[model samples]
Target: MERLQGKPFPAGYNPEVEHVAFTREPLYFAHRLLIFYVVVKCAQLMGHGFLLLAGHRRYVTPTHNLTYWHRPCQQEEGSIKQPPLLFFHGISPGIWFYIPFLTRLGRGREIILLEVPHIVTQLSFEAPDRIETVQSLAEIFALHSISKCAVAGHSFGSIIAGWAATAFPQHVKQLVLIDPVCLLLCLPDVAVNFLYRSPPTNLFHRTLKDFIDPSSEITVSHALRRHFWWYQNICWLQDVSCPLVVALSSEDDIVPSTAIHYYVQRHYRMQEAVKHEKEDDAGEMTDQSNASGSGRLIYWRGIGHGQMLVSLKAQDRLIAAICKQAVESGLATRAEDIKNSGQKNLRRSRVTAA
Candidate 1:
């Protein structure tokens, strides 16, 4: 058997070597060794299969489950009106991990936490399928009258959110991407290899094997293939029209700040034009300007990919910005509609006067 050793990589110092193979030893106790290996391997496979099944079933909110906790918005009075902010949790772990952030945001907005399909119950897969699954969930929300709301996603969830916004442009008025996985244009090969090597399960190569398994690989690939599609999806962001708010963490190990900055600057422009347009129309169009100020990009200095949503302060800031942006976008969109109506009225008035 070959021993795995630690090595320094771009993301961090990992103790495991990349692509090391293990073999069953042959000796006086060959029969015992074979039995032990088979037992261990079977256990690993069973565990992975169980997780895969659970993850697939729990990925989305069940349509039949009716109980959902609700809290009135802090910004509103007895009016009881709050913009829905759809949230997507990151990989591994589970949505319950975000209770801190969710509790904070729940104080003001009706948060729809869309769990990534099969993340907890099944093996991870490629990015495209994950995107498709999220898009389907977004459509479900729209079918239930969840139109013109702010959509937020973190890490891998961010990629899903981006696809959701792009796929259903009318449903998502604004987007809040927190330390997104796909925004990074280029990642070091070492980092990508490190991510793949870790492979959720450390006891055996179960997670890795399941992910590569042809029978169950599609969903697993969509969930685990983040590094491969990072650049491809970032490039695809150029086609998204809805205003975006990208909150990046400088201390993220999984994704570098340089990559986030590049995509935000290159593709979305960090709301510079929108802000400028708002400022330009400030005097003549106060409501319109306020609405145009919806798009924003925020950079948090010392937060990691996982810690960004765990912090109370971070959650507060994120929720506040998202709520404000949603309101502003709605106001702006409505103002434009009204402006068009006024233009039509003026045209009629002119014809009548003439």
Candidate 2:
């Protein structure tokens, strides 16, 4: 009997035979087709299972006016002074998908997971209260006594991170963005057109149903309903002033690299504005004085959008840089210093507006 790749088969099934058997051929074909179908079905089932799990609530925090669910970080004992890292998840299979990565990062540190409303619900894209959602989150943090923390967001979540940093700069000391969706840069016309023309209903039903399962109709509708929030996120990024560390995946297909570069350039130019405004004001410092230039753009070669979370090597390097900056900023002052700085900044902003 001949073997296929060293696995022995029955004598009649050998490929070296002069003639193929009629009865055996049909059986072989059927077996191959069955294997293929089963593999495909398993893959589909797995995808749907992930989507459903992503929608499940992991942590719930309630205040007087709002209620939200977030993934809680796994904390180690005796780590009181550990800095808090807030993670804002992306648009796909919810934060649950990144549990392994988050669990690793959360060890010996404080981590807060922020959940965008309607993420897995049927109203995902119809975020009429988008701004209020973020504001409420900020208030939640304040109520929870999170004075200053590192804010990190992935993809669509980056928009939220950027907005939070700008709206409440005092609270967010470090900003980390991964494969951010910079809508301002030159986007492929087809992609942009697709985003503009496709209603959330059609998009949710088509893409989610095809990739996930037809039975995931409710989940699909919920994710699609939040499409408007994605649009608002673009505007939020433009006005962000916090020191930012952006990681761009070299192989990202959903977000173009050009857009990322454009956003960095725009923010760099804003840094220049800070420099110009301070020219010889004596009390004012150089452009480098602000932590914004601590701003960095890191490119991860061969990493796809989703893989960045799971890549141990990539996460190590990225997290190290982010934590280093956070520590430096944190050490520069005690708790009182942070409070005073916040008060001074508030007064300065009001004066400027007047």
Candidate 3:
């Protein structure tokens, strides 16, 4: 059975959690929603949209069952070597807002984007059991005939991905966490700043908070306050398997990214040391240091949470991580072809496989 004991908030988080009152957002929320809704609609009208993707099979929100959209590989299976991507999105209205990022990610492989209603819908009073969430994900995996896949998640979704990795190790081949809230969940930062903090007084900050930031919204505050359980959501690096990449944005307003960056890097180095001692051939042990691209722990400077949704450069960086296996595979095939053709290229790029 899963533990129900929740981590306590630091004294600095708030004087009293139950007594703390929430602030009202500006009236522009409705207007902003309509305009963004139009933008999503326009993005749909242009050429392709996520809604049209196949396999919507009766997605029910109340029971905590997840619905997924799969984008199959356009290329031959032999040429594409990357594991199938099982993606979980962060707190957002819907998956429509993430088309650009997902589109770039789906270039050469099967990508399954799973939808989370509890975080996005705000009306859900309880987040599903982590075990149940992974079971729901397994259903999608079975649909795609995928036994093992790389799991990638953002923010709230990262919590689910971490649970999946820890709980079902055999099924999760790799993990990529971005702006993840689950890493240092025991810390008071997210709950205190995102849900319980007072609204910004400055006009510009107020506008940014009320209009752009979902954390400033009343329902989001309620969702985190009532439904979020810190201990249940927390993901410790000690529990995870190998080939993990943690991407933290230095300017993230929600999660304490700098702390997370250091924490993850230190954990990986420690894990490498432990593995090295166990193996007779220490050379076989994986190197997960900050300098090693394999098992990378990236800290993106000047980037904010959810900025990758629009920024192609940010998406490309993440894309490189997600598609690392494919690039390596392609390079290997090129080298093989060059060798067969009798071309003498003395130098070859060294690749450390995850």
Candidate 4:
């Protein structure tokens, strides 16, 4: 993995990812090897079928280290040219868990899915650290000529997506972070590590714990906590100029709801302060109504960290919020008009049937 040359990383930053160098006794090694094989097979079976149906295309960068999957819209050039949506999945084997949401979200626009380099690499080696991964993702975006997009991330992916907005604010029109972990104030590093490795309480987390590469997950989790722990890293959101929506689950076990609330409150308060400052100066705020640069926070009840992606109610809420933001920011046109038009058509059909 190549470090971002000509640019300095942040203080105390490590350029490369470090893996656990535990000596593998034959029996233990074989056991782990078999488990890994089963995990990979399960991921392939569940995820590949959806990708085939969606016509998903995976491309390896000319440099080979950076690769991503693209699922183009089946029908483009609609009445409105909506901005494309890019997804960063949580800590799962792949984006297989999100295929349902991605398929639905890709209705009229293209969808791009990014895999963690370490997880996707065929070689028996770890990939770059968080910072390099972010840079690599930006490289992919630029390579594809995607100047503006709606970037969304879930769980671990949220941190990457957030950094993407901060790193390439010029290119991101909107950012949606769902069930983000370790972005806000949280327990100590020891507690975080313990909870991450603890037994899963549900099927979703169980799948994540089992399928994801353990060495990579542990490495990234600790590195991210060290690098991006609330005050040190997430506070950078204060500098993110794009419109942001943070969705939180009140019953989340991995990330405390209090931390999420703290982040949302603090961010909006700061935005409000900025708005007030602009008002006092009698200067017009920049794109005040644009969804590309606003902060909106929402809380959902009963949804856990994993359920948010699969729950229909949760998904509907997220989709509605996105639509509302897009309509308000003028990213999606004729939404209301189209809905009303569709309603009229439905009513006519019912009457004719009667």
Compare the candidates by lDDT and give the number of the best one: 3
Candidate 3: stretches off by over 4 Å: 1-64, 76-79, 121-126, 202-208, 216-219, 281-294, 325-354
Residues 1-354, candidate 2: write the lDDT tens digits.
Answer: 345468766455656543322222221100123453355446535643553464423344443244333333334433323456777776644455566676665555556666554443222343425567566766668656788777788877777777777777777777788887644533442134323233346865655534443113333333433234344556344455566787887887667765676667777777767666776576666534466555677788898766887799998878766655655544223345566779999999999999
Better of 3 and 4 by lDDT: 3
* lDDT digits (tens) for residues 199-318 of candidate 4: 568988766655453433443433333333354335256666777888888887677676667867887887777777776787666674233235778799977667876788888888
Alpha-carbon runs more than 4 Å astray in model 1: 1-80, 121-135, 186-222, 225-236, 266-294, 331-354
Best by TM-score: 3
| Model 1 per-residue lDDT tens digits across residues 1-354 | 123436544467666654421111111110123453355346545643543443212233354322122222344332223556777776644455566566565544555666554443233332335445654565457555676666778776777687777777777767778877666445552134324333445645665545332222333233343333444345255555666788887777667776667766755443446556666776344543333344566777788666876577776777667656655555223344556778999999999999
lDDT of model 4 at position 59: 74
Candidate 3 accuracy as lDDT: 0.66
TM-score of 1: 0.57
Higher-ranked by lDDT: 1 or 2: 2
In order, what lDDT does every prediction score? 0.55, 0.58, 0.66, 0.65
How well does candidate 2 score on lDDT at residue 275?
A: 63
The C-alpha RMSD in Å for every predicted model, in order, reads 12.6, 17.5, 8.6, 10.9
The number of residue pairs in model 4 that clash at the backbone is 3
Q: What C-alpha lDDT, on a 0 to 100 scale, does residue 308 get in candidate 3?
A: 68
Q: How accurate is candidate 2 locally (lDDT)?
A: 0.58
Q: Mark the 10 consecutive residues where model 2 has the least summed lDDT.
A: 22-31
